[model samples]
Target chain A: MTIRIAAVGDIHLSEHARGTYRAHLDGIDERADVLLVAGDLTRHGTVEEGQVVVDEFRDLGIPVVFVLGNHDYHSDAEQEIAAMLRTAGMYALDDSAEVLLDGRLGVAGGKGFGGGFAGKCASEFGEPETKAFVRHTREIADRWRIALKGLDTDHRIVLSHYSPVKETLAGEPPEIYPFLGSYLLAEAADAAGADLIVHGHAHAGTEKGVTPGGIRVRNVALPVLGRAYAIYCLGGEEL
Target chain B: MDIWDPPHYVAARVQRAIAEDERTNELGIRVDIRGDHLFLQGQVCEEDQRERVAQVAAEAAPGMVVHNEVICVAVGEPGEQEVL
Candidate 1:
């Protein structure tokens, strides 16, 4: 049986955008079996905005899994927003993993950080500020590695708000590549094994890419997709 | 001589304002300064958000002609499913 996964990111919903987006989700149940929201569900990350996200996503009949983006941390209320999502019966992952589709599929990841790609990436040396920035990405990658290893399923997927490889961020300015994503994320997923990786946060990025390990990567940022969501079928003949 | 703010600096400031301003927390809006005009370009999800982004850009770079060229993103139905 193929698991149809519908994914999107960077919705940036707020009070002003209350029901405008949900209107587009009509008939989503007919399109996919599950929905994966990469991140950036709210414009300001406020609890109020989080409520908007809940109202927009709740009762969709499909399992809705999400992570918090940098925009969702603006008000230092990321935890509160995540709690709200959990209360609404949604899965909010923070460097964790979840088994869905009756344990046939496993998803691991969180809001991946950025430090550029392999050769051009940042190092944990030099000033404390620079080291901290790179270290944060390193830590998140480590947690993902652990999460992926713990999962025992037929297929595995990684969901994040940041890109894992630069291939998906082609249209974005090269100068900002370091801030868009890091290679550490792809490395962890590659080492632990995954069927696919989904991410966002690069509005101008493209939609498809692959990790060095041959895992497929898709950037479902709403702007990049020009649609409400994208559906990817796993456990097919191609896989 | 009134030394005008550097065009790059003006664009950077406006871009930062669009991302950081409470009224408009849009992170991907592109702000560009050419001569005396500042152009704002990006896809917002709502018409009101487009206006709010433009308003923040104009307030960030007063005295410059601000062009609000940002468009609203179309959230159409779910397209074809890619089998992997």
Candidate 2:
């Protein structure tokens, strides 16, 4: 069977652009079977923003799989937003996994960590504050790795808001690499053997690449760079 | 011996494709493709649009397995970003 996956990330929608997905979503018909968002659905994480996101997905042709970003919890209303998202039929994943494309696709979601980028990333061997940052990122990576391993489907996709590898982050400045992404996340995806991984957050980074394990990775931050959504297919004889 | 066989695995060709990628002055889609796998690398204009690039590249490969790893590089700093 041919399954099309359409994904985008970092679409910072607000009350003004409520239901923004209503218009451009038509591409889904000619494009994909499910939608994967790479986080940052709101200008400021709030129930209102979550509602807007939910409303936008109300018309999506297929199931919507999503993960939250730092912004999604800006107001510390992550739980409220997550609840409303579930009510709206949107899977707001947080260190979680779900089936999509009518169970043809196995997807895991996590907000991810930003201890910077590869070669310039953070380590867990510093002071309390520094160790906490590095360890925190490690925790997220560990959870994501566990979730990816738990997926039982033909094609597994990991959704995150931060990057996992430097190959995918060619354009971001080296200095801010630590806060932009980390090699740890990619390590998790690699170890878990996921088929593909998608993320946002590095708006200045490039748009395509791979993990050391050769799993696919894409950065889908909308505001910083975008034209429309992307479409990819899997589990076919052609591939 | 086959324990490490990859999904849509085409190790031989992907290595050659990436090696040739260094010669391109323009962002050519064919070179960006690995083996039969596709990876969208380099700078892009906006966030979500990077998705389209991957789609187009995959479509161009016609049955080649695709693995999108496209990151979104901001065009400018946060507030400095104006209507482009």
Candidate 3:
């Protein structure tokens, strides 16, 4: 049985976006078994924007899971946004995991942070601010790892708002790579061995990559996907 | 009298200007200074954001030439394969 997973990120819906996504996201029930939102669901992370997101997905009769992105924290009301999303029946996974399709598919995610990539990345031994920056990414990645490990489903999928591997950030300016995502998330996913990984936040980035452990990574930012969503069939003979 | 390079001053001012503006702050636009020229680059979700960035840069450094290279692409406008 192939569980179709549809994913996209960086919607950045605002007041102006009211009713914009409905036409684009209608009838997803026939196309996907589940929907995964990778983050930036709001332009400024307002509860009103979150309401718009809820309204967009309320009628899409399928399970929806999401992780918040940096933009979702801009207004510092991410908790309110998360709560609203939850009330609308979407799972907001922050350093958490969920089992779907009768426990056959496990999903885990967090709002991954950035501290550069492997070779040229930030370290915890520098300035206090620098340490805090890198430390946050490390902590999120660790939580993701633990969440993935705790899942006992037949197939595992990792979701994140920030890119894990630099491969997906290829088209973005090289100078901003550190801010785009971190290698720590990739390291955690690779360590846990996921069947697939999805993320957003890199608007100009490519759509595909593979972890060091060969787990497939995809950047599903709405801009990158150029679509309402992309569906991936998981846990079949193909895997 | 403290002497600072004009370009550096312009860059610093532009940086603060962008940071102070809510829309531009969310855009995370980067300001680069080369001599008296200011280059702005980042991904903004709206066309107005691009214009606002240039406006902010201009206001920050009145005499500096502003080169606005920010890309304004609406999110989810491309490759929309919704099964409608």
Candidate 4:
């Protein structure tokens, strides 16, 4: 069975974001089996802003799966925003996956992270606040690793908000390299094994790469240099 | 009006000093210029944030110099480039 997933990210909408995606996603049902958002749905982490995105997703006749982006945490009201998105018939995944409506494909997901590359990364046992940041990304990595490991499907796909390898950080300046993608995410994908890994958050970064283990990676940040969405095939189980 | 002076009163005198401190020193970051002079003082996250603050400050003051005192707070540690 073949499945087509419509995906995009970094909508960055606020209460004023109502008109943003509806016009774009109105014909979604005819597009694919599921809609995947790689994160940054709300601009300031406001529930009202998330609600705006949620309201727009109501136009979809298929399942919508997504991971929360850093912008979604700007406000402490993340739970409220998650609740609102859930109420709008979207599945909010963080290192988790669900059997796609077709059942042959399992979509695993996580928000992933940004810590540059392996040479420069934050250790979890640092200052209290610093520790929190490092630990958070580690947690994101570990959870995704586990979630992907747990899935049993004909086709496995991973969705993330942060780029997984340096290969995707092409156009971005070297000074800002670490901010665009994280090696931990690539590490996790390699260990768990996946067919296709989709992500965003590298607005200036390139759009493709591979884990050391050779799993395919795709970056879909809307403002990134190329196409808004990537179309791939799940007809064969390569792994 | 309120005695809550936004730590930027001394911004003009402390750009390098603030930029060297582990918590507030930065290289390519932009600073915001709000609640004060065309030059604003604040702690931003990344160089992008700094650049953004500078852009906003400049637009806010078309002719005046938007003195940038916005220090980039290294979320992790120094000797490092980013904390994101």
Best by DockQ: 1
Which tens-of-lDDT digit does each residue in A68-135 have in candidate 1?
99989999999999999999999999999999988988889999999999899899999999999999
> Candidates sorted by DockQ, descending order?
1, 3, 4, 2
Put down candidate 3 lDDT per residue, B48-80, tens digits, no spaces: 767878998898788788899988654342333
**Residue range A121-203, candidate 4, lDDT tens digits:** 76777589877766777888888888888888877888888788888767666877666667888888789888878887766
- lDDT tens digits, residues A103-155, model 2? 67899868888786556667778589999999888998889888888888878
Model 2: per-residue lDDT, tens digit, B16-84? 343233221112222344455555555433354455555555444567766766554442311111110
Candidate 4 interface RMSD, angstroms, 1 decimal = 15.9
lDDT of each: 0.92, 0.69, 0.84, 0.67
Fnat per model, in the order shown? 0.93, 0.00, 0.19, 0.00
Residue pairs clashing, model 4: A116-A178, B19-B25, B29-B50, B30-B50, B30-B51
Docking class of 1: medium
Give TM per candidate: 0.97, 0.71, 0.86, 0.73
Q: Candidate 2, fnat value? A: 0.00
Task: Give the better candidate number (1 or 4) by DockQ.
Answer: 1
Ranking by lDDT: 1, 3, 2, 4
The CAPRI classification for model 3 reads as acceptable
Backbone Cα, N, C clashes tallied per candidate: 0, 35, 2, 5
Ordered by TM-score, highest first, the candidates read 1, 3, 4, 2
